[model samples]
Target: MASIQLQGKIFIIGEIEAMTGLHIGGSAGELDIGGVDKPVIRNPLTREPYIPGSSLRGKMRSLLDRHLNKPLRRDRPQVRVHECNRLADYKECSVCQVFGIAPSRNMEDTMPTRLIVRDALLTAETRERFNEIDTDMLYTEVKTEVVIDRITSAATPRQNERVPAEATFGPLEMVHSLYTLDTGSEGSVDSEIALFDTVLMGMELIEDDYLGGSGSRGSGKIAFRKLKVIFKSRKHYENPQSVPIATLAEGDGVSALRKADYQSQISAAMQA
Candidate 1:
């Protein structure tokens, strides 16, 4: 058995705050109401709008895939992680390396997925604010939109329920792992840092893009706030006294995301 050098894991935690009214559609079908064709997804227990981890993670993977320009194999338009090894080969693709690859039929050789995203719930602060508002009004706001026919000038109306702008949801958390193996290779540290950088870049890409649904129609603009990544190792877990890798800077807003220095700080922390 080949020995594996256990590199530390990074936990990126923060708030995803809505910059514009955000609508992540729920399972609710066509309903009889003021043209409310779609409604925001909610927690069954709290009945409050929440961002599912799958929604955020899927968007990140898609954006990264687009940025990487890695399209599906001509023969295989869709491939599972297991199938990834045989068809639509992306064995070396960084996006796949981080996000995941479908398990191969054998499944013995597949690497574990490095990224973990948890469902983003309303922040405690936001929950408190909801208490001040009428419980009946706590449900998201619904916006009615019209689809106009360009030729006949006919109008069709549809409504979408959305989490209002300025509302915050989180401490959304993601874990990215780094592993060094026995295979002949270049510096693992640099490789790990590079992978982490890609994760950051993915978040940056999404900001220019959007979150949730109907982004093109001007919904789902969001920003990560107080975004910080903490590094932990097996030793730290065992001893509980060992200091973790230096803490990352808080992601203030979209502006902070745009700064080149933000990327540099990550590299510096890793090297330190």
Candidate 2:
């Protein structure tokens, strides 16, 4: 069971089907050639649309890299795009390679990785307190805290209005169900967390279903259930300094814990 202790709330933004002015089926002028469904489409059962983490992460990283005036690296591919391929052989394509695993045999039935946004926060008093410390040390600490907060809050899109809205879904609308953590760092975390809290406070949790078809004709639907957020410490894990965002709920901890205990067993079985 691989467990991560998160210290903040997990906010999910429901997927909205963007009207791309594109239609499916093969037809020049009602020709008899066979046609297929749309690509980058959502699966009906899951209601939630599939946006590869690679897509989201890549876009964000590019924007961030551009803002920072830094040259981007070729090695670190975006997470969502990497996971887009369903074929086992292609699983090593990029993002899925992180877990060192491929999509299940029934790729359509398998759950696509839920996109998550993590928000970290700190008290106002804490920020001022740190300012009194030595310049170099204080600056370094602040930078670290900023990076963590940026990573967690990276998922929310700034051009939200341009995209379709998910209001009909009730409290879960625009809400995402994911595991979150608020590692105590500094005031940097507070600002980021506050931003998410404000954005998700009144969103509805919708249960609409959408069909997600892959390039290989593999397809599945998604239905969102509950939406929740959790907070915990990084000190609990073996790699105390690292942060993790999970897709499972707190109640699902038992299964996750068991999996952590026998990771080798699970990995072996998965490979077999």
Candidate 2 CA-lDDT value: 0.28
Report the C-alpha lDDT of model 2 over 1-272, residue by residue, as the tens digit.
Answer: 22322333333422222222111111233322222112222324432223443333333333333433443334446532223335553332222221223444345422233234321122233335534665322111111111124656654321001112221121222222222233334443333333332222111111111222221222122232333333322332334345444332322112222222222321232222
TM-score list, all predictions: 0.81, 0.26
Q: Measured by TM-score, how close is model 2 to the native structure?
A: 0.26
Model 1: per-residue Cα lDDT over 153-254, one tens digit each: 998988778888888999789888877666425366457556766677788878889998889999988888887767765456556555456565456763
Cα displacement (angstroms), candidate 1, residue 165, comes to 0.4
Model 2's C-alpha root-mean-square deviation from the true structure amounts to 22.2
lDDT of each: 0.72, 0.28
Worst 10 residues of 1 by lDDT: 79-88
Q: Record all residue pairs in model 1 with backbone atoms less than 3 Å apart, i.e. clashing.
A: 80-102, 81-101, 81-102, 81-103, 82-102, 82-103, 82-104
Candidate 2, residue 75: the lDDT equals: 41
Model 1 segments more than 4 A misplaced: 1-5, 29-35, 73-91, 105-108, 133-137, 150-152, 182-186, 254-272
